[model samples]
Target chain A: MNKRELAKRVAEKCGQSQVVSTLVINTFISCILESLEAGEKITIQDFGTLSVKQQKKRERFNLATNKVETYLPYDYIKFTASKSVKIKQKEKSVKKE
Target chain B: MNKRELAKRVAEKCGQSQVVSTLVINTFISCILESLEAGEKITIQDFGTLSVKQQKKRERFNLATNKVETYLPYDYIKFTASKSVKIKQKEKSVKKE
Candidate 1:
């Protein structure tokens, strides 16, 4: 499911109009990404933690080239799901509420 | 920032009430988790791809125990960030809209 489809489902489940749901969903994404870009560690209840992690530069020797290649340092997003999510994964199916 | 703080920020940015924003945020999380539990891959544009992945079982020698250890397979959530998000990370500051 993409954002559009998820928005529809969210709208129906939350009793909100499609327009409202779509707007809020888009806004939420923008807001979260903005925070993430700012290097904030965001923790969503029952979902996960969103943060940026740095991968240090490393040098590796290539047997074929017989030279060391240095890789640049990098920053990337990391998400660690909440324990509940893991429990749910084990459930194999969502229990309807 | 946790969900409460995130909801407050989202509410301020989206011009929604704190109550409404909180409700919508909670609902959105629940909706996404429900789908994830059902084995659906969720793709949020400009954010990332959310999916479940499995780590297969393997045998490894335990140096301390001096024996072979059998590990069971494990399933976990995986998130891959979009290219735009990486670009945003480089921006260091969000462009005010």
Candidate 2:
């Protein structure tokens, strides 16, 4: 589902208006982005953990040009779903087959 | 940061009470988890995309036991950060070096 639909559902679940729900949702997203940008890890109960992982600078060969290039290191967000969620996923797969 | 801290920040940003903010945050997480469990993808603008990925059933060797084992297929949540977030990460790395 998209953001709008998700917001609607959240609003209903929280007994709030759509506009307020949207604002809350937006704030939630910004909070996560800000935390990651600041190199902080975020852990939501029953959801998972989100953190930034840095990759080291590396050299790679260009097959076509036969040249070596250096790629700068960068960071990326890593998310690990909660064990309950993982178990639920496994159960769903088992049911499907 | 943990869920309580996140909710506090969100509450302050959205000018809502801590109780309501916590409720909204909980609902938001539940929404994503439910969507993934239902095999739906959730995309939040400027944040990232969350989807469930299914792994095919396969065979693996148990090194200690030295026996072949059949592993059942399972599903996992995959999150891809937004382009802006990626660019920001690269810039942060550049500054550090």
Candidate 3:
């Protein structure tokens, strides 16, 4: 499923037009991106939280040179879904297969 | 930030009412959750994709008994932000401090 498909489903479930749903979806993404870029974490109840975490730099082997190399530290965004969501997914997968 | 803050920002940016924006945001999250629970991956351009990945079961030690124990397999959701989003986040963090 992509954005378009998700938009269609959202529109159907929310009883809204697809165009409006699509715009809302896009705007939601933009909003999330803006918040994350501003160093803010977004949390949704019964879903999960989106936040940026700093990854520590460490020495890694240079495959070509076989020498230790230092890599720059950076941030990574992580999402940990809620337990209820995971259980629902597990049940669905189990039923399908 | 939290959902309310995000909704405010989104409403301001999109020129939409907070109620509508909140509804849209909630719907968007629900749509994504549904897709993931259906074992389908949802991708948003310029943002990221939400997918469930299987985690292999393995044997682990029972702390109290200190004996080998079988662990159940499960699924985990992962979100990898796009390169552009990462760059923007890095810049924003750097400027703030």
Worst 10 residues of 1 chain A by lDDT: A87-96
lDDT of 1 at A18: 83
TM-score ranking, best first:
2, 1, 3
- Each prediction's DockQ? 0.46, 0.60, 0.58
All models: lDDT?
0.81, 0.84, 0.76
lDDT tens per residue, model 2, B1-97: 9999999999999999999888888998888888887778898877889998877889999999999998877777899987766535533566445
- State in Å the error of residue A10, model 2: 0.9
TM-score, B chain alone, candidates in order = 0.84, 0.83, 0.81
TM-score for each predicted model, relative to the true structure: 0.86, 0.87, 0.83
Which one is best on TM-score? 2
Please report how far candidate 3 places residue A89 from its true position, in Å: 3.8
Pairs of residues clashing in candidate 2: none
Best by lDDT: 2
lDDT of 3 by residue, B1-97 (tens): 7788878777877777888778877888877877777778778877887788877677988999999997666778888877667634644435333
Among residues 3 or more apart in sequence or in different chains, the pairs in candidate 1 whose N, CA or C atoms overlap within 3 Å are none
Off by over 4 Å in 2: A87-92, A95-97, B87-92, B95-97
Winner of 2 and 3 under TM-score: 2
Model 3 chain B lowest lDDT segment of ten: B88-97
